[model samples]
Target: MIKPSSPTPDHLRELKFSCLDQFIGPFHYTNLIFFYQADAAAADDDENGYKSQALKQSLSEILTVFYPLAGQVVLEGNSSINCNDNGVAFVEAKVLDGRQLSDMIEEPNLEELKHFLPTQHFVVEDNIVLLLQVSFFDCGGIAVGFSFLHKVGDGKSMGEFMTAWANANKYKCNKCKCRCDDQFMNNFNLASLFPPVEFLRTTSLPSTTNLSEKFVTKRLILDRKKLTDLKEAIVSAPGSQLKDPTRVEAASAFIWKHYIIDSAAQKRRQIKLQPNVDQVEVVVENAFMAQHTVDARTRMNPPETNVFGNCFLIAATEIVNYNDQQQEMHHLAYLLRKAIKKIDGDYIKQVQIEGERYFTNLFQRLDPVLKGKLGLCSFSSWCRLPFYEVDYGWGKPLWVCTTPIPLKNLVVFISTPSGDGIEAWINMLEDDMKIIRIE
Candidate 1:
């Protein structure tokens, strides 16, 4: 049994405030996908009762254990959603059949799901949806999937909380010993940094028109051999001086270029809204090559390392310009590479200091033609994530997927699969998906 720490005194309130602020975001979204196998005997034994009772019981215990940490989850910056005034809104449901789960999981319908979720304008109250889907296989095992919002917390923080909750549930049933320490929760305060406010505005406001477009999710598996060959080609190129860029970096660049070229091509094919508007503007932005290192104070150099929560800031490689003529795929790819390289650690730090200034200047000198019609902008490739480490004693998941969540325009992610190479999942408009190039 893990020992409990002394109760945190009221004087040390800043710690709690900092913890809450750290998790909240002005412009951030995150989701969690959980896969589980049901126990057949348990289902058969509880024929009269709901088979999912055990799972619900487990979830209840986990939430109780995390009650203290719940306050830490809050909103930062400017957000239309009022999380403080409205408590955590979680939705729970099960997938009756595997086919149903497969259909929704295959190509994510982001716009449809967004509509179903509680929005600020739709209702007087605000809430977050926690979608739970359960499928029973012929073999008697059950699979559970969780789709969570990132506004609450990042993947790392979500995993830690889930682990603690699972461990607590296991201890209740005497299946395993509880090793969770109260010190983890005692050191932080939950209600200081961002006091409940009436209204908050987003840095970039949403479009006035309703999003009528449909969305689709597709997967592209790049095996080890093929990935190796692609990397070799990139490295062997005469001018390519990045001695060794990882497969993730190279693939991200390749995919990004394909999309940009296709976007530009689609623009050329479109009919002008007006005769004066001859040039089309395309903007491609992504969080590639953005690395956030741990602070010195937080790192345990010699003995231990605290790898809990997401201790990183988000940065993006953005491209904004007007094109009167179509550009070649290769040229677009090269420009993306150059833009990504320009924001190294030093550049990022400088941007961090003067980022607001730069944006302010740009907005002040905004172009008349490019005032409102900006196409889909995105960020992808969530590499080096610790998702697999979230083992709730049932071993790692066979496959984990996150989809149907909307960003400003779109957001794509690629992560290592338990069995092989990488799995690519995108949350985009149906029209945007048509132009996406995997090659």
Candidate 2:
């Protein structure tokens, strides 16, 4: 296990390395937003105030927790890109009028922020930003927004770091330090295990020309009763008797079906100029079905385990030709379930190989259509996730929401909200969402 040590001025410089870059994926990034309620009468000053003291303590703790992992964090390729390549710095705290805070939410300064820190290419230029915005609400609550680049870590790692940072701050670690672990810096050869060139193919991926106007976020809460009923319905359905149909499988199947139906209906409303265009072409795609399980190798082999950073991989799944045929919801669900089941031991090895092959020869064989179609829809189910235990001192957050990053066609975030079954946060084109008929 890695332990903390004293902080150094050149700590970040020491941690920089190239090997860490290869592990991160385009969508592996994660950020944690914490909301706090401050005393209304608290004064805002640099020297000695309740809020000031809290902020200082928090910063100190953040540095301590982050410093040791700075090399690991930076080399890991999330927030490091912002600090090193781009001139992105962490946001400091300040008092904002409650009215202004509320207004900003309705009309976010997305363009202004983008101008401040434009997106950078991952391979050529690293541009990842971590922003912490504090705004006072009329009710005396503080709104904290932690915006992170999605290419760095996933939701789980982000949550773990936040909890640790909060704990260090709350306890007031006066003698905080930074320590580097050799295991974190070790270079492992992954090329051999990945796919070879012979089995690879490249095609033009899809691209997004126009984005949706007027974005909104909705939270759908699934209680225990509803969850149980949904599961029972699925199990009793024909061919769903697989001994144990996990909740993630069942929920994903349902959501995927919903998305297909919604997309088809939207396409029907669009005006097609082609003559005798009786059918509308609408495809439902997901970012990738990410199955986060403890690496079996880590448990079985002691020396080979490198738990310094994230040890997970995302497997992509989609219904390519939704417009080609009319299929029942349950039938689609069964297909999805079957696809997920196919991702067992041997399948993971194939995925690793294929992924490596794609990256190695990405530039040469790139397909225009496939690239454009990528990220048309994303589904992430964090059902068995441990996000709630991410308590610093005040306790876990009351709620969390993500900003609308342009280019992504549709995004879905599934989390088990505090005291509920599951929460699905869906972001899609305003027009596309309009056609969704939820029963």
Candidate 3:
């Protein structure tokens, strides 16, 4: 365990959860892995020992700024963090396989890659807020695994924490104490802005509709050429409603088109298998839903760029006629853009004014998916996030990866090292994957 170098002040003992944070359940973590190549110039017999000690010390110093991380979640009435400076969990391991980091990064194996992290899917049902694991490879490379509680914040919060820790570790051996302490000391104002709305996640609205089925995660790299081609194809079409769609927009549209086509085909096959099926009654109109997770930090009227809390909106787009628009990628991309554009300043302001009404609309939109009437596929993009900035005195990471989440029909987009290619980590039902996997 690594405690804060300095204790948390008594006045700031409790960190309340924002209304958005209350929507996320307890004990779910945001897990990510960063691989670093060992610095050849700093070679020594005690490299691992020195690195571990330096990491622990820097972590202790940085914890003072992120005090909530060193505390436990108090789940009595309104969930809050007990910032008593109890500290966080840290672990150290050395890989004995003698394989270099380069051997496995070309096309990562999500199943075997789970060994690098502390958990398979970041669910431990524990009150601990965060844990860090630094695994040293036999070839002198290093893998850093970070698991942070989801209830505390979203991906943006975790990214800021990781960047701060890296900055601390970068100046550990040096005499610059200022570098170890993050400059942003303002306490997060999310709790004050959006107090916890208990009804958003009460027991009365439990997620009992969850399907118990096996899901598999797969990674695919979409290079720059493919993305450019897709964007051009969409924008060049006459009377196109898109405004030069971004790489993520184009890529997501492409995938959604294929999913619609294949799933509609699968539904036809299943319908034929049933002898008494009424063909006219089973018209699969808009069976698939496309949802995109957007960070609301920049979308706010007065942006909350540095705040730490759960602040992402899932903008879901519905296809009214999937059969007609299954192959129309341009129309699909345009509709996605339109949906995302609707979640602007006015929408968020309305959300803040009427909390219950916002959740009512949310549940109403989710009712069909929960009832198995619609397919749910949400996209989360970390392409422009703060992963490449991590440098723990050795250097920036050679590769960055997020562990597979347990949720099915989820797609995560990550930028490659070159920043020109995108890596799509998709998770879906085992049988549905077979249909989507078809070339």
Per-residue lDDT of model 1, residues 1-439, tens digit only = 1111233234431222222233333333354455544444544434413545444555554443344332223244432222121123333343343433334445545343332232323211223323344444433444444544444444555556666655654455342456555524442222221222222223432232233556466656677776677667667765655556566655555565556567666665563444454342323221112121222112222211233333333333344443432223233334445555554555534433554443444333323213445343445455455565545455555456554544333444546554346665555566777886664
Candidate 1: pairs in clash: 16-189, 30-150, 38-142, 91-130, 95-134
lDDT of 3 by residue, 41-132 (tens): 54344978898899999899888889999988776654678998888889888776676677758766788777777655455435678888
Q: How well does each candidate superpose onto the true structure, as a TM-score?
A: 0.64, 0.65, 0.93
Stretches of candidate 2 off by over 4 Å are 1-31, 37-52, 61-129, 137-140, 174-216, 241-243, 268-274, 278-311, 318-327, 341-355, 358-376, 407-409, 414-416
Q: Model 3, which residues run further than 4 Å from truth?
A: 40-45, 76-78, 173-182, 201-212, 278-281, 284-286
Q: Relative to the true structure, how large is the alpha-carbon lDDT of every model?
A: 0.43, 0.42, 0.78
Regions more than 4 Å wrong, model 1: 1-30, 38-61, 68-138, 170-178, 182-210, 271-311, 318-376, 414-416
- Candidate 2 RMSD to the correct structure: 7.3
**Top-lDDT structure, candidate number:** 3
Instruction: Estimate, for each residue in 1-439, the C-alpha lDDT of model 2 and write its tens digit.
Output: 1112335345343432111224343432243344443434443343224543464455544544344332233433222332222222344444434343334434544332221222222121233334344444544445555554443434544554555555555565433321212322342222233322332222222233233345544445566676677677776766554445555555555665666666655454552444465432223232222122233223222233433233344333443455423234345455555655555566555545466453444333223224543223445655544555554455565554444443333344445445446665555556556665443
TM-score: the better of candidates 2 and 3: 3
| Ranking of models by lDDT | 3, 1, 2
